[model samples]
Target: MATTEGDQKLDKSTPEGAWKKLLSAQEYHILREKGTEPAGSGQYNKFYEQGTYVCAGCGTPLYESETKFNSGCGWPAYYDNLPGAVERHEDRAYGMIRTEITCANCGGHLGHVFKGEGFPTPTNERHCVNSVSVKFKPKE
Candidate 1:
């Protein structure tokens, strides 16, 4: 992968450049380039907090703190998303098939969704999100 000077380190020197400076290459790839960070490796899997999770790319509101749940899948799981805030696509990457979710506004890759979540919620959907793709703002 070609690394731009911007890609070497997150340009966190300014609030506007924080995302670029704080995130790693893989994080930049998955979050900004719409690539997938390998599952079972995201930090949000073990995150238990009360906060709103916003898109790391554009700061768009995506999931509420209340919607988060543990799927035991080593990834951050949510039963729902903020209405009309995301777009889905059929991802055929790496010879495997999965549904890809992206931020509706900036088109930054969030993660994939899977069915059969076994949750009692109406959606029964599991939105497996990447931690690098999101930033949690805890409720006060």
Candidate 2:
């Protein structure tokens, strides 16, 4: 088996059962089980601080503070992500087509990205991420 770059960041020695024990029920559900937290109920929904946002599962830097914006969509909104920080896939769940974003390093479900919603961003795109899927590291 080849040890990919992603495999180096996240500890793979831990078994699935150990991961269940390592994370909380909610974190497990959102990060591992591909579940979503309720909108407007996230810690980062209204949080704006000077720092970088990293993946909760693997601590890979995903977004910078300057990329964040207030979309009033009840979630942490970013105009962009750090280069190659996340991967996008076609999500066709729940009778809807959406672009699903996940941590490139750990493959944890971050949230979805949407475009053409009329947001004043350089790319006119929105990376709507789940708070539980990320951790904020304040600049020091």
| Cα lDDT tens digits for candidate 2, 36-104 | 999999999999999999987767899999999999988899999999888999999999999999988
TM-score of 1: 0.77
Model 1 lDDT, full chain set: 0.77
Q: What is the C-alpha lDDT of each candidate?
A: 0.77, 0.86
Question: lDDT tens string, model 1, 15-115?
Answer: 43554565678767887677766677877778888888887766678999788888887789898899987789999988999999988766778999998
Model 2 misplaced stretches (Cα beyond 4 Å): 1-15
TM-score of each: 0.77, 0.89
